[model samples]
Target: MNPWEVASPCTQRCVTRPTGNEQAYARTRRVPAASVLRRYASLTAALGSALAAGTRIADPSVLQRHARCVLGALGIGLDATGPLRVPGTAAGTLIVANHVSWLDVIAVLAVEPVPLIAKQEVSGWPVVGPLTRRTGNRFINRDAPRELPRFVGELAAHLRDGGSVMVFPQATTWCTAPGGPFRRAMFEAALRAAAPVRPAAIDYARDGTRSTAAAYVGGDSLAASLLRVAGTDGLAVRVRPCRTLWPHGHDRRSLAAAAHAAVSDAVSAPVLAPRTGVFRTARPPEATVPPQLRAHA
Candidate 1:
């Protein structure tokens, strides 16, 4: 069975900165405890509102809209550059983006309530877990490489059915780069499903400069990341949508390379410095989602 041929449903689902323009972001050197506290309170309130609205309505756009409002209250601003260029009437579109912070997900959701393809672990995260479930995300277990083919096939089928799916092909987040390297696997899904691929570049800026405060890299705890983000002023998110790519006889490897280049060209290049801030945790070789979490054909 071709991994790209599996037609199964998914079991799980799963910012920037400032300046004056430059002076808009607070210039305070130190993060005050009170400010962080206030931000957390606002975030909590926004989250509660979203959760309540989610239970009452099944529309993803509504959930995303509510979440977007809360994120703005949390002090994150959004800016979109370039034309989105996606066909409004096209059967499901595939969006591929570079992952920077956990806020990247929220940024995209705020812009559009698109469902996502995320790791199984994300399905268990604190506030994010329930939100993703409510939004109907597809979660994959990274430990089981053997299942990738079947999973890709199912993903391809979903796309073929006019269902939109978003994926972070890098599979992990990086604080200082456009992306690590584009994995070719998901590109295969586009080929199989004949879906148009849209590469989006997402960046975080503070006080008119790129900021790493939102990066959930290395030993940084979630609380620490949140506090840092809340404390930063003029934190803005920039998203650039590149030209769309069609299969057009392109193979998966070529497709992946093209998408990677398109996204990289639109964003800042990765810094060459030691990325000690972003640690790569090793997973158990056999760790994978339990049977109950996966979708059956």
Candidate 2:
């Protein structure tokens, strides 16, 4: 196994089943193919420029601007709400959010640029890989459960040194809002470092209505997802940060549950219902860890 591979409980089955092909087709309003091509071209240029600039630009504000520029090139608007920064006296904060699509990374960066804990495969993805590494994000190998403890320890140390981190506790992407349960492993690091946990919610919408056109679940390829996003008109991502949870008296499990509930509540609010049939009611199976691995995690 590759040393950097990460494990995830989510699979193709976790994807929400659409009512039917025709119904799903009628709901989305896609732009012309030429428009999609133009968007992709703009995105490519933006990424290239970012790569050329690379690590030379270490300022968070500059990085945030670049992220917003990338989103603009892709024709995706960002609406971030609530407190986006850590309190003045906080040593560091651990930001956790539900995973929906690959774009979640860029959207979060646009609001608050921070080091991310990403899966190893992300490091090999075209221009994005090189750019993310240059930004000093950490990658993990989920395949090696034994290394989890060391990784968590290092993360705690980083927090202790007053460095904030962003992580997707869902581990894998889901089709839409209220995705999957938060994993407890990363929460352990926050507890060890005495950092606050901030839960954020991310969802995509077309015009003013909720839309799943940007979901990257099932057997969907990155190229296919990117094209879908580019072809969609009036697409926007809404990011809402919930109240922070202190770790003074919380365990990893409790902290994880609290964060998950906060995010779920934030996203579960009533939005304009889709014109199509109802979303799937089934939930994905919970992730399981062995007793020995659980101790380290």
Candidate 3:
């Protein structure tokens, strides 16, 4: 916290500066806090070991509650609604959601019971990693090709234990409602784990104003983004339904298609509209939804 405090550029008083602009953010750092006493109070009630033993995590929802209040006080409305459940939860599930802001995971966690599948680097982050780990987040090396198999194995073990896992298949944040193709890694991992994949689309809405960019993600700096959150309006957790996925074995195209359909099912088509603000599509142009994923109810 000390390093964050520096003399304001034009004043003698110490203040922290926001580093890593949009461009610089693309080059580094991905990944907050609170009324400490309040958080502890809430965590004790929401995430007691007994609750975790029951295969449930209570931080995201609890945090969401507090965040909603704070955002509301600042005139930032967090308007969220339906498509709140996921399948495979009874036998260990894997949730894949559209990525917009870091809060995306929190929203899913609030609704679904699962441990987060985060980037391995997050485990070493100063304050972020500590909080994440304490909340049961698992990490993988986004840059490591060789470690893929090991990662898969660990996920399989976790699922076999009837534990749910949540992953960000996009690999990067996008404005909400992009409806982009899900990544192959996430698809493949779900397959290897033999767990059902729930494609959950998440977004934020306020005063009927929905913006995919509402959460600070993509080429945004951690400090800048956090400040933006600390300074802004309320955001809702618009949860789409969970489109259930079968075990993997399909090629990348098939897997992507399956994911798209699940996500699309959760949210209506043409998810991007002026009324919808902006959409971000960061994956390959050819990625699509597979028919098998949408064959049944």
lDDT over C-alpha atoms for residue 191 of model 2:
86
lDDT tens per residue, model 3, 1-297: 221111212210101222323321111111123543343444344333323333222355554443343333323333233323333243366667777676666455444545688878788876456556766888877566677778777887787556777887766665445335666665565565555666666765543445433445434576655454443333344656554565646664687677777676655532332232111233212212344322233
Alpha-carbon TM-score of each model against the true structure: 0.77, 0.83, 0.62
Best by TM-score: 2
| lDDT, each prediction | 0.67, 0.75, 0.51
Model 1 per-residue lDDT tens digits across residues 167-253: 888776666447576778988888887777888888766655566556666555677677778887667676667777777669999
- Models ranked on TM-score: 2, 1, 3
Give RMSD to native, each candidate.
12.3, 8.7, 11.0
Point out the worst 10-residue segment of candidate 3 by lDDT.
Answer: 6-15
TM-score of 1: 0.77
Better of 1 and 3 by TM-score: 1
- In model 1, what is the error at residue 38, expressed in angstroms? 1.1
- Runs of candidate 1 with Cα error greater than 4 angstroms are 1-31, 55-58, 81-85, 88-90, 268-297
What is the descending lDDT order?
A: 2, 1, 3
Residue 225, model 2, lDDT: 80
